[model samples]
Target: MTSLVAGALLAAPGVAVAADAGAPPQPLVGDLSTWGSPCAAGEGRPFVRAVPNLTARLYGAGDHQPGEASRVSGEFEAWWLDGDGSEERLTFATGMRSDSTPFSWQLPAEIPADTVISWRVRAVDGEVASPWSTEGEGAPCEFVLDRTAPGKPVVTSADYPDNNNWTDGAGVYGTFHVDSPTDDVVSYVYDFQGGPLLRATPSGPEGSADLRYLPPAGGVFMLHVQAQDRAGNLSSPTYYTFRVASGRAPAAHWSLADAAGSRTAAATAGAAARAGIGASFGSPAPSGTALTSTATLDGTGHGFLTPDASVVGAGKTFAAGGWVRPSAVDSVRTIASQDGFGAPEFALGLRQEDGGPVWSFAVNGTRMTGGLPEAGEWAHVLGAYDAETGRARLYVNGRAVGEEEAVTPVAAEGNFQIGRSHGASGYRDRWKGEIGDVRVHDRVVAPAEITRLGSRAAQLRGHWALENAPEGISAEAGGGEPLKLAAGASIFRAGDECDLLDPDCIPGDWPLADEGHLSLDGTAGYAATDKPVVDTDDSFTVSATVRLADNEPAHPMTALSQGGVHGDAFKVRYTPATQSWELVMSHADAPGAAETVVARVEWPDGGQGGGHRLAVVYDDATDRVRLFVDGHADAGGTAEFHDAWESDGGLQVGRGRTADGWGEYLRGAVDQVRVFSGVVPDQDIAGLM
Candidate 1:
């Protein structure tokens, strides 16, 4: 007989169980209606209700029934079905004896959100199979995993400072802002074209990124920025373009060119003249004869004359009047032609016709040509060709001499030379006659204006000469003493009775002369006087034409000094180690108190032994200390000591203070010694050249 264990059954209730002794129990087979209690047919009976996380169980009868066998084996299976009866296997248990109890099985991991898991169970005891239980349906169970958060960050604002005008060597900065979900920005990257890549921590909340860049050169540069989240999600790249300019503007300065001392041009002449004006005319003048006219030649030969200098025709049109009598009329040429020195070679004052005094101008070398002027005595020539108006006219002595349309209308090269062509090489065509009252205007000059200019020219003659003498001091002495102007001469005499206090006894009669000649030789060295002696302390420049003598020492030699035993006083000396001239300042009373060495200059070997001009200028305003040899700046330095001269000390030249004799006395000729309180620029130096 099969024995069934009555454990807790999670199946439909009210099912009939046949438990007989000594006979095999028949398998229970009936609809879900038959498994109900007898009180209300099957419809009123309680059935298994499938709920979430629950399973159903069914009991089976064994094949050993009554007294046949003690135990019976069986198998059971369970499955789930949908509302349409599509079934999916749930669990299957094999080798289950009749004594087997019910067990629970878990459902699959994944299921539809609202699906009902309806399941039923069946049992087979030996060869007898039990009927299938009714299906059950219940609410479905599901779980949701969500990772989407608040929202993605949005770029709110970006601020990039314009570095377009930034100097090349200056630092630049950039900044930007972004709207982020939280204060947890992960990383940021910046790409620059020239330098290294820049990175920074992404600012949280009001997200911001500040970057600095130092540009190398001038050009357009592109930059970009990218941001990433903790998950390494990178945002779109933002780009910008900027420029780094050249160096910043320099401090304002006003310096004269090297030629400012010689040629004085009007400051208002315009920028063209300012750039082209050289230091000197250097021998032959570029222009033929200096045009002493009040007219301003509008760099284009068309003249803009003013009445102040009798060079009329500021805005006049010419029917024509005036005579250009050359110094000698060997070859008649037009007045408005290029001539005399380089390039444009020579321009004809007149056209190629020799019949009469034509007022036309022609460019000889270049392809520029013009019309002919009227002919009369002294050449009262007038001609006109209207470039914009397309008209031509000619008059001689206020009368129409000829009029015609120009066959080949060409523009003049605009460079007007008085004596020759624009080429100015003194070539084929040249002006020989003397031209007076040469005037031009924007429009053609009337006969009355021409006649008036001619009458004015007759009265105005002679050259405008410079009135004041050139501001300069000669080598000649100016005081009561006879001027000592020789090359190798000394202006002092040595003797005990030589009026040491009188101005007449002083060789140069220097303004600050106190103690006069201490020795016949004008070489400076330590003196034997117990009383503090007076020397040349007055601010003066001692310049000399130095010619190195054969016996001169090449060691540390003093050129000039005032006081102190050895290294004291302001002196110019040479250092053998550096081979450079040094301007040393020392004081005997204050030893090791920081004596200043202002400037040093090295001279080549061949530069010595030759006659050279040496000048030392001490300016108080700029405290500009300078020393020049052979008209060139050899050694120069600046200082702030305005009053370097002591009242009790007399000035000494060519050597320093010596106890026995003039040891470092310059063994060379000394010429011009000039002293001025004003500062001279390079232009003044070049003027002397």
Candidate 2:
């Protein structure tokens, strides 16, 4: 047997191979022939070719065509090269048995775009090395990396149902569309100036996002939409602007008909014109026309001027007048006028008679006896004169009361005053009774005008009910809408209730009024111990016309409590020790953790007992909590916990907790207690005062 000497041969500095003489001489296992770029379609196969030594047997040979050999334990390796021949390994295999053996590898995720890879296969035996197969250059297969993202989302449509002018409290409908040509867009984020308004996701090929929103009560708002791709790329944001109006009014309904009308009008005046009347003008005017003629009168009150411009003619010496009936003959007077009776420009005169039992009229500052009737009853009177004619006449219920020679020409100013006079100064001053149908004529008003005024006066003698009430009171009359009882008086204890009359009826007791004042006896002690009591399910506003006494309590005391059961409650209170009024809010869900001190009030003198009006408004829209003292905003704050405090607890006006338990009653005179579901702005409060 020939001795087989085996020795280790160094292939490279870090690699070695064993060669045995008896095993057979090794073949050169270098110089792979297949490499270069694959086909454009990336589907072509690669193979290796090299000069083969047929004399050497491959040890890892198998039945497969690229024939495997036992000596080859690992995979055959292949790679592509740049034009410069810098090689990159594409794949690996164990062994290659034949000269025509092939090798293949799939593209990797990290491969660069447009790369050209080439590959080859090699075979090796225990001591003999088989040669590499021929190398194949693949057709250039261009690699593509995803570089696309979704484009900016756009607001395809936006609409405000009411006012269409983007005014306050209007309903908003916004539509968003996104286009992503290359990648799939998955989600979108919408941002609103007031808060996060909505979020949307793509539904299908032509999907859209929609939102119905209402603006906040006091400011302008903005909405934005942003789209994101599946790969986390975001599109630019799209923005829109809308306005919020001041008061509480329902959003107007929208219809295709209305839109068509607007389009028609716009088309006639160029679709770009923004302010002109729309085609929808054919529809009945949304808000009816202003007064035009007395024929439209309901006969319950004064009618509009008779459109005869001559009645309110240009340059005439005619004096016009009518009759009046005072609803309540109190010391203070009520009047009607061309300028809002709240403030007027012209005037008729009504004063107590000598007997103090009757009411008479003074026309243009001329006092006439036996011409005007009494107060608290329909009275007839007339003022007629043509200064140019030097004739003045006064009539009572169609009969002449007094007459005077023309002295001053009747003022020819366009404005006329009915219940009261215009200008800061006027001879007749203001009328103290409800005046009826007033008429003016370029010529002297005939006796027929006086007769017609008297007839109209007969029908205008009744009272109307108040719809919106303030805070803790309820009112009722003989027949009409129930008068709302507002807390317009001082805060009292559990025993003290409210008194609509006597302004000084507030005591340290809770008061309840159905028709009149419900006063606390002040002599007794009544307090609420547990949670504050409030009219459940019923909404209210708190108002007080109060005159604080010198001996009022100095500690913290509630002015109004707005919760009934063991749930959420809101309190408007005054702390004399701190010289401030505070609004405290608490919810049962949070236990003793109250979200209190929403607002506060600081008085310069540390007290507001000398007669002042205080009000607190709770509105659900903005969930605004506001306090007003003396017709001004004392404090204001907001919170958003809806339906958290809806329980059935009758309202408690002047004390803390309930009137049954712990007594922390108020001390002072209380008047009107009003409540409303809607928010009342400062302007309305000032008007009421």
Candidate 3:
């Protein structure tokens, strides 16, 4: 394992963070935990779990002497007040120094479940003891301890059988019954699709939960269930196994191409998922499709909700895909997902990893990346659970980007969602983008069908209207073409603008948009795409907002580089020895020297890599590479270097590769890392910063 050696580094100076002057007061006993985590591991009902040492506080303000408040004589005691106007003293924690704000106690283990009683505190100083703190403190605050676990729950399914016969097919909505062994059981814990455990609250007084589960595809499935009582105690788990024959039409569908703000949601083929209170509609979608609009979720708590979770559950084959346009890529955002009350079954979304925004399909929260998409650009994305192969697959623009042998997926038991997921903290990971034409299938869609879905959506190339291009993908944007970023958002351009109105717009020159970037770990970490950014023999431009994890590094590092044979054709790196940012080009594939251009400006005043924009431009005709700092070329002649050469290697972020293997890892973070095919004008490059 790589050590977090950077943890020993000091935080860089120059960044200001406001201190939180106001925060909640900590409990007197810092280790006193009230959450019911241990209950899950406790013995089933009728058996109580052991309680650990607990603590309490007594106010002795009235007992303290005026001048000597730090210490006092006598003892302090605590009591539990019953509802019947009677009190039973809590048997412990009796220290009597005025300085002792909270007294502690080691109560007997195995407190009876459903025990609820009020509490009081008293202190005595020598012979003059203070009155109990029950009068003015209003009704005594309740102290309830429940260590008993609930009885094991009973789980049954009617739609699929575990007899090993492949009968039921995919996309079938099935019902599950979770019955508690005890009446007080309030909820049930269940596992689906080898993902996280989920919760289903009992809607009836008899302690039962009726759940609707959708088999997304074909596979052998095992469902695990457990009961939870009101005291937050859990019972032993119950398990069930079932199987479904693969290949069937989807039972539910959601095409998010509804009108703007249309709360009356509808599905083109299956059950409809209702729009939320903050529903936004009629956003732009991809071209070349019958649909022209999409639903935009703002990433707060807004999304479409399907009351019944007729999606896929544990061990079921499933496939979901859609067109998405994100508004931001700096954080986690879910476009399509479903889950129960506790853990998530799956989510198709965006996350920042490896120093860039990537498209990932998660199975039980384990993300498999598809590719990278620029914010404000359009892309088709999909996730699949291949039961036959026992694998998880992800695709971007119809091309497989990532695949892995499947881990057990936890099944979802609550609801199907568009643009968000549910957890203990309510809805989270909401999508801050436009998502539509989402289809969930019972079987893993074949590659040809996946490709067909994307091709018909739109064929627009290169830059798009903020549809968000995934990073590190051999993605469809640029249609494998090349160009330069012209604005803050991605606008793929050659020189200035492509105007169809001028009747001179070239098919290959149509305007495409992208202002996305990639990230890198300064360690031995790096990212590579399938194609090179551009031929180094030709003019090209690249820029990124960069920040280093370590303010001061032990050695030099590269933010970006491309290779062909023995050496990098070009590299953008920070040389610690020179304390400068340099752009390098190799003179030969062998052990030859390189032509270098350095930025002459002092490092930005902000500490570490405080998001400084660095741009490298190579004008092949001029045989020179120009370096710009924060959008402007430093006045020093060192900013430009002659004798540039072409490196045909694919674009790599975070590290460079040499004849010696990969080295020069970037220890910092970078954003808005854009690569264009042609050199943009000085004014255009300046506008990016």
Candidate 4:
């Protein structure tokens, strides 16, 4: 890397000399370079991988005359500093003008793992050779060559075990130990889920680092770590998988919102229930998000039952119920219940003798019944128990109805039942009505919060209004299946962000502030769903608010996309050159398939602005894709797309995947993302905005 002037023979590695009266001015060798070095060395030696393509620079020099130019030949010499003065030389001509040019040679092989290299250059003709090049101080120029990769690092956590079982709680922090000290590792690079690689420096020569990280939400997550040596060499990554139990999350929730179903679907990851022949799903529900699920049961002993174990223990505090609308109040009709060997463990529904149905919140045989709910009218009913006070309360439409009973409910540990109950006589009292948003909270609910459970919940709580930390990724309007974290995106406060779903389970450290937006570095970070958000072949809508770090980038950048076999099935990206927002749809999942870019709307700022509400809808019915900006249809952003294929990859926020890995990262903030199963109406999209 070192360079020297030919006129100054006082010091340094590059050879230089002053023109004498007689001979051609000694050719000057300024500096040396290796193909492996990413950057040039200006003042000191450079480090390069071994067996590099080495080159030396020689200045034009006079051959026949000491002060004039003439054709000349040059010799580049290199020697290993550690080896006995053995030298290697290569020869080249400077052509007609004896012009300055680079002379290259293959660096010596068969060298030790760590070696120091030095080189010099000179011009020669006939019987005369130019003085050897050297630094002004007569010091040799040298560079270190290192080719060995660092050893793999070991990742260990004392608090959370390997992916054996779910950790005790969500958001629990674990300090992971990383090191391969003896291998000359200087730092560690790690990331969560597939986020971004963050560097952690070692405390000392041990090359050991302890990284403290916490899971923002529940479900399975992984941490990747690798050792980085001083020479910028990285070892293969060590993957650490961990699980955080959804202890505070609902044990099970049936939205009953399926379009048509004999088998009911659930929002939560586990806790699926089976619908009986007489039970049907996808019925009209009280005004709510389209995600709301409603189920109807024909009174002929029909209902839904989950094949899950009892989630609520006898002595534990819990809340269970849903939205209900009954047909007749004749017999004891149960909306939801858990079985008991003899009588029913508990049931919440409508029951009255001679007149209108009365809302009932019954646990065992003790019923907290009152409040007349007109037949065929929708009502929110809940049965909540607090073990600490040994009290049970029934709520109708956010208000406690009937007297609060201090009853000790027996353990109704059995399959969760819906629309029917196992009374002493037999499996009777099948519900002849509609039930929606059935949920079971395995923890005690404070009376003040019970009121916020139904139609009374906040406007922006997504499907269920569940609270999540900045690190945790919730379903938004998508429902209970929270998205998994990738490389870990952090949260930042955007003036309009909302975080009203402050559930009891959220950790204390999470501040109850404005809604936080996702901050991505346009790298390997994004939020991912466990399964594909939508069947791309079907009509669907994807929307979110985005603010990019820069509106005009050198390349196209994606705000959201889903992966296919070789590329993305669909991409909501900003094309820098066109200054337009485009929705690209792929024809197939394989590589080099025909692609259709239907929507193209140039931003008002001519690619100078980045904040906006963006949405893309693919209506399979018309085979057209529509783009919306700030909830309004974009005339310039509409066109037809063909041969739409279904993508099986999970929904990815802030990035698009290529054949090799993730790319097109959105470098900015994204908030309030929502993916709907079907095309959302124009007015509805605006209303959501």
Q: How much does each candidate deviate from the true structure in C-alpha RMSD?
A: 34.0, 27.5, 23.8, 27.1
TM-score of 4: 0.35
- Model 3 agreement with the true structure over 614-672: per-residue lDDT tens digits: 77777542345778777777565234444456676777667775556777877654555
* Candidate ranking (lDDT, best to worst): 4, 3, 2, 1
Task: State the lDDT at 398 in candidate 4.
Answer: 62
TM-score: the better of candidates 2 and 4: 4
Q: For model 4, what is the alpha-carbon lDDT of residue 35?
A: 65
lDDT of 1 by residue, 89-145 (tens): 444444544333433344344432224333334454444444444323311211121
Q: 461-544, model 4: which lDDT tens digit per residue?
A: 123122344456654554555665566466654332444354434332221223455666767667667668677775678887
State each candidate's clash count.
Answer: 59, 99, 46, 31
- Write one digit per residue (lDDT tens) for candidate 2, span 1-689: 11112221112232223333332122223322223423223433232121111121223433223343233422333344445555455443334333343333333454432343332333444444333333233222222222344687755433432223545342222333434443456677777674755677767566445554534243566777777654355677777665555433211111111232343212111122121121112221111112121111111222212111122332344445443445444332323222322333223444456544333333334444443233434444455555444456656555565445444333443343333334444312333433333444334444553444343211111121222234632332234223232333322333335453667766443222222233332223222213223232223355644433333455455655656444336666667776666666665433344455665555522223334566666543234566777776732533343333554443444555532443445554444545443345557775543
TM per candidate: 0.23, 0.27, 0.35, 0.35
How does each model score on lDDT?
A: 0.36, 0.40, 0.60, 0.66
Off by over 4 Å in 3: 1-54, 62-69, 72-90, 98-100, 109-119, 133-148, 161-163, 167-174, 211-217, 247-396, 399-689
TM-score of 1: 0.23
Q: Distance (Å) between predicted and true CA of 304, model 4?
A: 41
Model 4 stretches with alpha carbons more than 4 Å out: 1-30, 36-47, 62-73, 81-100, 124-130, 158-163, 168-175, 197-205, 210-216, 247-286, 289-689
The most accurate candidate by lDDT is 4
